[model samples]
Target chain A: MSEVLVIVPVYNEAASVLRSTLEGLRPLNHDILLVDDGSSDPVPELVSDLATTVVRHTLNLGQGAALQTGMEYARREGYRFAVHFDADGQHPPEAVDALLDEMQRGEADVVFGSRFIRADNRALIPSFRRGILILGKVFNGLSTGVWMTDAHIGLRAMNRRAIQCINLRENRMAYATELLWQLRHHGLSWKEIPVAVVYTAYSRRKGQSSWNALRIATDILLRLIYR
Target chain B: MTPIQLLLFAALGAIALIYLKLVRYQLGAVVLLGLVLLTGCIAVYAPDLTTLVANRLGVERGTDLLLYTTVIFLCGIFAVVYGRFRKIEEEHTVLFREISLLQEQVRRGGAAT
Candidate 1:
């Protein structure tokens, strides 16, 4: 089995920092890399105290930069795969094994924990957010022609090869769209599995607005047109 | 020229100036300018409707209406510039935080060895 490294990017998530996330992953033998993106609290020191390896960014450089920092570290440390996990408690640590299983079975080069998958776990999502996600799926399907059921799911695993091939340049949240576009552009093999998304008030606040979705669509269109 | 026609021309000129100066969305501004030009053409060529509306509104000339619109458009431009300033300030705050972190890291590294 390939060594698994979980990359969690955190901003000012002091409330849920080391307690739930570190405790949840304590059982797993995989290496955990926490990128503290210029958090105001002393998250670096707190996370360092835990068994997990911690990387600190002097200032908040957005999620894309933090993910890149973690991925680059994983690549350097010679991990077989790196999983992008949210700092928020929405993504369950238990689902980590399922993702790894899919990767190990050679089912996918990249596996997304899709909330929209027609599985028993679909009921866990809120209806309002589900509608937004369904719209996003349609947009991604039309834009990339990949028929992806979910485009914005944060829980995803990428092997070393896939990570190395995709060069993410966007510094903001739009990086998610860029990643999908890169995957499509390079003709990469990927799959999606149903996973429960726990939506807390904190996660809800972090969620993108409808206006932001339109902006992201416009940005993607412009990028495709220019490129 | 009737008061309505004069006001219409002034409004067009003011809007054109504001569009050239303030708005970032060029496509939207061009469309707006096109509409303004079309309205001005109608006021000049179709005098009966223009005069009737102006008389009902109690405005002396179309030029006066155009002047007021110009003032509003200039105010809109000012608002756009103000918004750009705020965005720049937020970006600077993020940059400053990053710099402070780098400086602290360097100081710690120097002391460790």
Candidate 2:
């Protein structure tokens, strides 16, 4: 098994989509761990023969919970590094090399895949989504005090120290902010790498709606008061 | 007692009973319930006395004072309940994560890693 674990959190995705995602990652030769967040479609079962381990959640916890499970698995299994990859195929598998390469430089403990890092990648994001992402970036910067080019990108690589320190409490969409907050709280170094996001009809349907931005802000406020 | 006073008494009694049952083990809640029950009884039976007290506190009427205090009290209760629910959810997540991790280990025949 490779020392780096590619952690993919799968919800109710199609088997074909998941299969193609796995096929794309096959060339990277990393140990893949699929955190099945109580998906109804059984996509992970279809790709069981792909040399990946599947951890199933009996109930549908949110994406934040699924990612936390993947991180915990990586820590427990003694993986040296872990990459957060999307199961919906939006995040290009080839970008995993960029994340791993940036990670291997030993300068930053975490390397985030950012579309806003390069002008070409920025042009690919839909205009509507780009507006929301800009708002999110500002809001997250004010809240977490750590600004980023992208606020909620799932493509990220974390070293062992980051894997051990980052404990996600938000079980829903607010986790993106929480992760950034933890970066500052733990004093972990981080960098942003240019990456492309493939916006297909399937991914767009599964993506966050505009209304979710309000909910995420509310969640962050409640968490701040509760904490 | 007037019809309204009787109705209010019944409502207060029900609330006190429910609180008593729920907070039997909590000393702070028991004390709070006692104070609220006392205030509720005074508001129901001795309107003039509460109005007298309200006047001392610069309030218009006893019922108005009760309304303002009740609103504030309900807001506090809502916050407490919401915080409790969030705590329960965090515990549930931890339990679910442990179960998922253990299940994966079992599937791998309890092999390390």
Candidate 3:
């Protein structure tokens, strides 16, 4: 069992960016789980020989389900640390190591990578995106009572306990907030890291619309009502 | 209660039951069945009750109240079906991913390594 397993949930990502992203993780050489979320593209074929295991979804379930699949696979395969990375080239591959190191220090059960956590990364993030993240922060605070600087960032590393406790139900973008709620509800220890993301034009194109904050909020509200 | 109203209630309830069953969405079937019964009762014995409730709720007419309630009820049912479908999809994804991992291992000569 590897000490750390990286879970990258990808769907129909461009070949060029994925190749670069996979290559970027070569230095850490962590066991990679690339969850192909029912991609139309030949994602599995492209990553077949990338020193990684490809988990295929027959139907497109969405990023949350893909991440859950990857996390469950990591848990089953006996990984001490499991990381959540985006398929798009937004997240920094090496920051995964930083998150795992923080987990190993025994300070936190879960580590979240936040671009707003550091001054330099904050400076790099554009104003338009920061406003959306702040809206997410406010929503998280009001809905889940979990206050954070950034809420939508996918960069995360969790240990076995966190994996066992933080069960995600949301199948899409809303799962990010659901993960935060679960962590807060379970009273699990968590730390934040100042990780920077590339935010390339392609990644930006793939990003969720800021208006989607309404849909995410409604999903959370309904879950709360139905619960 | 008119014979016409009773027939309409029965017909609509039957349609709802059939439609729900056809879809095989059973999560809230019992609740839906209960709603049907309540709707039957309203149609048969207390159709004017809608008017009273509408007055209390500051709505204009009995039909308007029924329409509002029906829309809200449908939305609730929609939410339930949506949630159930999501749960089923997640479970399938989990199973699918597990099988993929197994197949991959076997392809690589598996535990024999």
Candidate 4:
């Protein structure tokens, strides 16, 4: 098995069951890295009981900044590959094994867990955000030259080579755009696997709005023009 | 001439002179001087027509001239402030990026040693 490190970026998801989520991933022989992005609650201390390396951001940087910190940590620790896990508990632990299995098969450098790859049912998603996701797919295809059914799924696994090439300077939701563009620019091999999404009320609250999505799209356009 | 009419002519003369001096051309000062002399001749010879036109154009006293000058000055100030703010934001972003790079180097160095 490859030396895998799972990186979870957490904000103020104090009400979510983080410990149970960590417990669920205990079977995988991977080092867990929990990045506390300046949460106001006592989440760091609570997560201290779990067997994971906890990194704290001095200030509340966005999700992109937290992910960059974790990725850098993984690289410095000499890990062969790293997985991006969401702290909001939308991703199931079982899906992580599938992602790792795909990685082990050497099919691609990065594997994204797509919610609509083969699934016919999506009862968990609200109609408004579903429309937003569809819009995201079109924007992603235009920006990255890759036709993905879902573009904003957080569950993904990447090898060290792929991580090193991604320059995630956009510290907010634009990180997703930056990642897809980096993959396209570096010509990195990638694949998408079907995975189920569990949308809780908390996840919906933290989800991107149509206005924020437009801003991200604009930022992506600017990056393509300037960089 | 009435005090209001005198003020109105003086204000118009000032605005035209200032606009020409700052934005139009250096030679505009000579043009403004000739126009002011011409206006003085009109005021002395055809005072009634000048006053009637000024009242009809709603240039009561020098209120219109004062309002126009104030608006232009405010717009120029706003442009300068916005430019400075954009410059500072760019500087902060560059500095933050450099610091992150340095931090990454330190982390790598520590691991290597």
Candidates' RMSD to native: 8.2, 2.1, 4.2, 8.8
| Model 2 C-alpha lDDT per residue in residues B1-113, reported as the tens digit of each score | 89999999999989888878887759898888888788888878888888888889999898788788889999998999999999999999999999999988887986554
lDDT by residue for model 2 over A1-227, one digit each (tens)? 78999999999888888899999998999999999999886645788688889999988999999999999999998999999999888988999988999889998999999989888999999998899899999999999999999978999999999999999999998999999989999999999988999999989998878779999999999999998
| Cα lDDT tens digits for candidate 1, A61-101 | 77876787777767666788999998777888988888889
True contacts kept of each: 0.10, 0.95, 0.55, 0.00
- Please list the residue runs of candidate 4 whose C-alpha ends up more than 4 Å from where it truly belongs after superposition: A121-123, B1-113
Candidate 4 clash pair list = none
User: Which has the greatest TM-score?
Assistant: 2
Which segments of model 1 are wrong by more than 4 Å? Answer: A225-227, B1-113
Per prediction, the TM-score for chain B is 0.56, 0.82, 0.67, 0.47
Rank by DockQ, descending?
2, 3, 1, 4
- In Å, residue B105's CA in model 1 sits off its true spot by 11
User: TM-score for all predictions?
Assistant: 0.65, 0.94, 0.82, 0.67
RMSD of 2: 2.1
Instruction: Give the Å shift of residue A63 in candidate 1.
Output: 1.1
Docking class of 1: incorrect
lDDT, candidate 3, B1-113, per-residue tens: 57888788778778777877775877686676767677656755776787888889999898898888789989988988987886786677667767767766776686367
- Two-chain DockQ for model 4: 0.07
Question: Lowest summed lDDT over 10 consecutive residues: which window, candidate 4 chain A?
Answer: A117-126
